[model samples]
Target: MTESSPTVWGVGTTRTLRAHWALAEAGVAYETKPIQSRSGETQTDGYAALNPKQKIPFLEHGDVKISESYAIVDYVFEVFGGDRVYRPATSAERAASNEWCSTILMELDAHTLYVMRRHGDLKDLYGAAPAAIDAAKEYFTKLADAMVMKLPAGPTCLLSEKISVADILLMSCLDWAVLYQVPVPEAYGDYRKRMSERPAYQQAFDFNFEVLGVTHKDLPR
Candidate 1:
């Protein structure tokens, strides 16, 4: 890819979808490397040179290279979104946005859903831990119970009318949790439906999931 081109590495995971979705929302066109985790793609010499950590959902734009889906989404919003996307304009607004992002990542993703992912679907590689998976599922439901209250009636978003980086992170996690049968909050169903109906989300979903026979329906297992 050229230096000015924005390129995203990896596909077939919620994390990868986050990057793709963010780019779409920001109205930035990018190239996809179409790499999958643990398929000997990230282990290649070329990918090793790009990211020593060998993780998917890495970003390359101009001279900047970014790892982590959350960071990439934040960067895309800051750099490319202009007024097309809503970005926190004040310190307090930023704090509020950060609060949503942090809680979603820690509580919904790493702390619960990811634990279930490692022990459940990926059991062959990570080794099944039924107790851990059960605990994770229970933890997810517990978090959802409290989190549902934070959501507003009708259509919902962390930020009222405008979608923010936090919403993208949340949509990705909610979908992942549902795939794992983690009992995601029912209140979020309509919220997710509305967000998924966005043209940008549809674009990203098609690119990330509709490659050949692979689809989001076949994911997480």
Candidate 2:
């Protein structure tokens, strides 16, 4: 729990939110070197030494320096070895959680981010023709519907009923989704609201924006 032990370098509104959420939930003390997208900090040789990929959300624990969001999550789970609330116990439940997290990151998050990039900086960012906004919107619509259908069946729902890593990952993605003005259906909208109401989610939201000094207001209306 010492400040010098586990240091994290992460970016604003990135999957580093996942690491922050897990740290907060686990009650672990960590020092965060938050990077900005436009600041060029991520590309510096100093940072590149820690993370060859030159990406934010890289973690350094003494001799260990790790990159990748999921890898950091796993490391947090192991090092803290507490907060079973964020991590499911049973193998079946853990498997399901992993599946949902992977599905969201691998499929839904990319699709949503593509739509965001296309809408926000398509020509300048990639210098290529982008997909139609309407088509992207429709794609998000289908993704939302499918995600909503995956909501838990029993008393323990993904957002409202229990605190799971899936909830954290989903909350992180939704943070960007909201800022990017990604069109989520009513069901997913409600789900996002439910997650946002939680204390952990609130902390993550405040920390991400505060450290980054960016305004969601800049997002498209």
lDDT of every predicted structure (CA atoms) = 0.82, 0.68
Candidate 1, residue 178: the lDDT equals 69
Residue 105 local lDDT, model 1 = 94
Best model per lDDT:
1
lDDT of 1 at 210: 62
Error of 1 at 173 (Å): 0.5
Residues 126-177 of candidate 2: C-alpha lDDT, one tens digit per residue: 5544455556656766776787778765545483354666776676666666
Structural similarity to truth (TM-score) of each candidate: 0.91, 0.81
User: Residue 42 of model 2: what lDDT?
Assistant: 89
Model 1, range 1-221, lDDT digits (tens) per residue? 45576999998788888999988888876788999887899998999999998998999997899989999999998898777777888998888788878888998899898888788778998999999988988988888777777676656566767778988998888878867777876777778778877888877877887654555444332
| Position 204, candidate 2: lDDT | 59
Candidate 2 lDDT score at position 7: 84
